[model samples]
Target: MNEGDDDISVDKNEDSAVLASPEVLETSFFINKPSKKKLKKGVFNRTWLNWVEYKSFLKEYNHDSSQAACIVCNQQFSVYYCSKAEIDNHIKTKKHQHHMKSYDVNQQLIT
Candidate 1:
């Protein structure tokens, strides 16, 4: 029709294109993230040390860390939060019960 209009003719015969989201974007955007674990709180109790043989100080797991360990079970647990409950839970475990029974038997024999 016009000088520039004649050069810009529509190409109706050409194929149409459909848009799709990329695989990388779909995975990253749609995936659910893992939940974070709860952290321990509170300081280790002073009297727990007396419960052991030394009866002087708790076997502090690490410096500046409120932690205690079960010598019978050979395991350490965080006491930074709810110190007594943490210890109680550990004591309630079957493994600790079994080991404590064996320890008592050994001690009686040694004496």
Candidate 2:
């Protein structure tokens, strides 16, 4: 076949191949959006009755008894519900000195 005919066939094949892929139908400025709800202002909103529900959620996730280590001191702690106050206390502890140092370093970097 002539070069012109060969080029046309190749173009046709490519067009058909692209048409077979469903994703090709979607044309937009693509963004990878988060699937999970992000915590805002360090507040986990729950009513008094919902506290029990939150506890159930923790137990379901097997995190009820799990302890997160203090970022500053590397001290082990079981956290039922995490809060800014708890984090502040942990940050002040001797165990968390390293974490606090890193936090300061990061803050400096950002500034």
Specify the highest-lDDT model's number: 1
* Residue lDDT tens for model 1, 1-111: 876665655578854564555986787665776667776467776667777642322366766567787777778888777787888787788998898889778878999
User: Candidate 2, overall lDDT?
Assistant: 0.44
Q: Write the per-residue lDDT of candidate 2 for residues 1-111, one digit (tens) a residue.
A: 776564544564355553434564343323454356654433322331145422221222134333434333435544445643544465466745655567668878999
What is the lDDT, from 0 to 100, of the residue 94 in candidate 1? 100
lDDT of 1 at 52: 60
Most accurate candidate by TM-score:
1
Clashing pairs in 2: 72-96, 72-99, 73-95, 73-96
Off by over 4 Å in 2: 1-66, 80-89
> What lDDT would candidate 1 get against the real structure?
0.71
Give lDDT: candidate 2, residue 100: 59
